[model samples]
Target: MQMTKRSLPRATPEQVGIVAKQVIAFLDDVRKHESELHSFMLLRHGQVAAEGWWAPYTPELPHMLFSLSKSFTSTAIGMAVHEGIITLDDTVVSFFPDDLPGDVSEHLAAMQIRHLLMMGTGHDQDTMDALIAAEDGNWVRAFLELPVPHEPGTHFLYNTGATYMLSAILQKVSGRTLIDYLTPRLFEPLCIENPTWDICPRGINTGGFGLNVTTEDIAKFGQLYLQKGLWNGVRIIDEEWVNEATSKQISNGDGGDSDWAQGYGYQFWRCRHEIYRGDGAFGQFCIVMPEQDAVIAITAGTGDMQVILNSVWDHLLPGFLPDPVVTDESSVALSEYLAKLQLEVPQLRSESMLEAQVSGKRYEIEQDQMEQAPFPLKDFCIEFDTDSARLTLKLECEDSIILGREHWLSESTITIEGKDTRIAGSFTWKSEAELVLTLQAIETPFRVTLEVHFIDDAVTIHSRYNVGWDKVNTVHGRAVD
Candidate 1:
């Protein structure tokens, strides 16, 4: 019973409406928060229950999954365990003999695979070793060398380094990379494709974070976990493993609040109503409600993960169980709201769709190459693509220079020198007339706008890269022709 594209169930128009009204309200309130909450998508059962994207975002774009990646890593470990390739009781030191510290204490010595899975790894700061020791490339050994203060089961510390060690152990016993190991058994079954995972210096997928995937794909994963790893009729993750991984094994959050909110199990977070979720740093979440038979996936650029959850609980939770399955007034409003969700992709608005020639599109770019020491080719021409209107500059052959391997362990930047400077990636255009690109380069995301104005003989392109104030770039094509 493999799920085909056609076989997936669509939410009934009634169900769709209920979900839509809530989404619209949630999004409206979040915008006022004035946060960097970039994108969001929601799923129920196995279908795209609801979806929406705001300015400077779209559904096709890929976003960083951050530490929500640990769930994926843990899933890989589960697969290996099912195949009998590794046992949870296997010691950490057993996987990487070359990196174990000489004076490892009895508690550290007693640490087993399950401890890492549960985030009970004894380290003062999870990333201290990797950052201070410069072990970004060789994270596994760097993590294993850290001090383990607590007895394996005595305490719980949210340590990502522990998860990285688990990834290493899986590679050690299974002899296959994380992506390769899960591709056939898990990824393909879910119909998720072309996922990009950033590799560490040692070439292992960063088990804690750095997995990039679509919002929809993560939703499918939540649904898979919700169904107890049963896709269609086939069980990919053993039922026992799914239960153990999601069951509360430790309490998290220093608030020391109720056990329901603070509990964690095998790389998953426990929420209200026995719900557990896979959550990432900047608001990527896959909340699987097994009892309710619902899964909610979200990908956002905001810093507030809890607020997102609070919103979910406040809005969507109520719709989960409608006692008599009411069928009229409330349902119609929800449907109408969902049907109104539009991408708002503006048309080119320019009179004709013809390629408007590039000869008149050349502009002298007085480029500013940041403060990191100007290397080469600071001067260039800005060339516009006449047919597509995508701004690109053809770099002279001599301008093509090489820079050595860049490290992301710290602030890493790459400077490309070209005779014709290209408009920044964020200084983008979807259509000729409607040009707005938002770049998340630093602390706050900045949007660059190019408003096409018809002045006498030409179409002048004015841009506001910093202030809303405009600076004319150049004019192109005949006024009428």
Candidate 2:
């Protein structure tokens, strides 16, 4: 089912307003907070309470879920456990005996299914990527053959490979693919129709990541976990297992204080707000706040995922509650804000003023910096459309892209439909020559608004997405007149 609106049951108006205001305020700050860095999709209490689509992104589109797929894999395991097919204590070696390494150490032999769930696999030297890339006939078998550098319970590593091994183990014990096993038990029950997950060359689901889905589907998964695996009065997953899986099982030394300090659970991260989330590369997130009885689902594309987490912990957590008493003032504000949220293609404003700026003029984009060095592509180009308000760009060794026009002087907007994505943004020439661009991706929960500073022959671009500006991907482009 699509992201259909679900009615609020027994709630005062004020509580709703708080959520609305926060969301609106959050969206309005796309540039100050570096919205360009990610693709964010946020859902509130089963309604499109507040939504925005940024440039370089759009709604009605799909995004890569990266490692977030592991959470779903873990959920499948929970279902299987309740059915008596396998127990968390089951041994990894039990699945494929012949695949074991030549010398199985005491530590490796002692590894249990729970170890995989906790990512405390006790294999220090081996990584999930390396394990999967092994030339062995079977990826799981390759993982099984790796040496156990330490005891399972003694260490914790962020291993997507361990998650893959879990999916393989489930298939072995249940005689069914993860998608097949979870279809009726999870997807159907939750009404997440036709969801897709990637498969390896070996025909196994890429357990760690590679899940692609709509933002609404992610919300449903969050709702399931928030409700403790119960859907519309049907108990699909055991309540006990839900509790155990979400609770902290291991301390991921890698994550720092506050939200990060809480620890890690079975394929989940324990955040500071007493909440648990399934997060993926960039910023794909399924955040469930049990105390708030609320779920916020987000699909993102960013370099540093923690900024997204920090925003949730710092901005969204404190305001949530299991059942909020509504207030009229808050509800009115929320309704107004909801009514205010709109995504439309703006009218084009002829670049008459820019005509003088452009006529036979040479331009250049200076001070291009990247948070992390962008590999493969060392240069880029930016060309402008005077009438349509468009910018055609080409990356030296990357993808081709186009930004469509903002139809009118009053309409300050840009629609970016690229080789791989559809993103739109609003633009305003706040100054005589400087242009302010606002981008909101309908596919994500975040926004990126950039201020383009014009110079004699150069433009300086800078933006932030509610976090530190240390990680910036800036580039300089010279107009080849």
Candidate 3:
């Protein structure tokens, strides 16, 4: 049967066998506790029950998926297997005979495609750094050279390099990059268009990470699996493949009740309550709950991933009812609440005593002080208007001006590292002499805050990041007389 591809149907929470009041309470709990959650979509009975995107992280933008990319890579491999281009029992070195090391160990010789898919390549620790540091930038060759201490399939290691190798193998056999291979087979079938994946230096897609897609796209993927690879009425992928991929294939640890420790499938982590998820760093999640016939997709920038899952279990799980329970007042209130949801912008309303004094004054920092800085800002000046504000920054040899409003304002083009990026910004006066500006890169899971404090003759700039390599740092600057 040919299945029709269309947008997911929308339904009120009560119509989907969930209480509207409890749904609202779940959202409230998320806002109160999980402050880093950027966006989420809740689906039941193949319909969208509720959805929301935090301020600056809109549904139109594609958020970075990080390790969530692995599951997609695994799907591509499954497709290739179904096409007979490869098999799980195929030797890992068979596809890249030319790249194999001269003296392949017995463990390496015994490695199979199934071993990689199940994260049982036998390495004790992650070997991704060695692949990145390869002099020739050939990740496949570098990975094959690394020693596999334990025999393949005997040990379980959370290896991203193993996932990358799967990508390389698919490309070698299918004569297309992983993204290209999946475009027609997976993305097109699901009505997902123009998805992007990060590529390695050698032009292969980084299968272990770097996939970007909208939150709803994540929901669609989970829904596909929930339906056993059936989209609408057609079989996009074999049901057997979906069953095997999500089933527990390897025991990760004695994690007791921890979802991560339960077990691991092919590129998917088995969770408690008969759920499975494709998750990434900082809380990008696509959770499929078979028992509830529901799927929850999330994008966030929080370190506490377990807390997010716990919140779902505590609030959402209990809300699912066996029969629909409709209430007019609760449904209306829940709909209104979701429509008005927005991430609060941290600010203070006190009028600054030095607002007018330092409004347009330029301050210059010592050259030696900024030599090792990430931004290396040389001079900066702030200008404020009744409804808008402008911040002008002088870099090593160029100047950039950022314009924002007192409330969240969207920018279509904000240049960062020479690339145009979508950004939303807002500013407020924390005190008479201190101004705080928050800038969020909407397409990415990152935010940068700049706090500039004005003194008699000098200014202090403190910068912070939501998540990155940089730490909180202060730079001192003097008025550029």
Writing each residue's lDDT as its tens digit, candidate 1 over 1-481 gives: 2467522455652454344455556665555554445455555545555555443344555566888889999999888888888888888877778777777778878888888898876555675357336534667666666667778866787787787777777777877777877789888888777776656667776678767766777777888898888988888899898999998887776433342356889999888877889988767788887766777777665655677776777777765554224356645664565444422322333223222442234333234421112112222222334222233222233222111111001121222331122121332234544343222222112333444433344444444444222343432333322
| Number of colliding residue pairs in each model | 4, 43, 2
Candidate 2's residue-wise lDDT over 1-481, tens digit each?
1233332122232344335445444544433455333334444454334443333344445666777888999999998888898998888888888788788788878989999999899987536667657775478777877778888977888888888888888888888878888899988777666667767667788788867776667777887787777777788788998898899999876555656557788899898667899988667788887766567766654555666666666566555544544554555665565444444433333242653564344344443443223211233333455443443332332333334445212222322222233445455555566555544444443345555556666655555442223444455445556
Candidate 2 lDDT score relative to the true structure: 0.63
Q: Regarding lDDT, does 1 or 2 come out ahead?
A: 2
Name the better of 1 and 3 by TM-score: 3
Worst 10 residues of 1 by lDDT: 401-410
Q: 1 or 2: which has the higher TM-score?
A: 1
TM-score: which is higher, 2 or 3? 3
Question: What lDDT score is found at residue 338 in candidate 1?
Answer: 46
lDDT of 3 by residue, 1-481 (tens): 1334646778878888988777777788867775587888999988899898887678878888999999999999999999999999999999999999999999999999999999999888887999999999999999999999999888889999999999999999999999999998889888887799888789999999989889988999999999999986777788999999999999898867688898899999999888999999988999999999999999998777888888888888999998988677988898888777776676586356577788888899776776544556678788877766777776545444454556777754556655566767778888777889887777777877888888987999887878753677678899975
CA lDDT of each candidate? 0.60, 0.63, 0.85
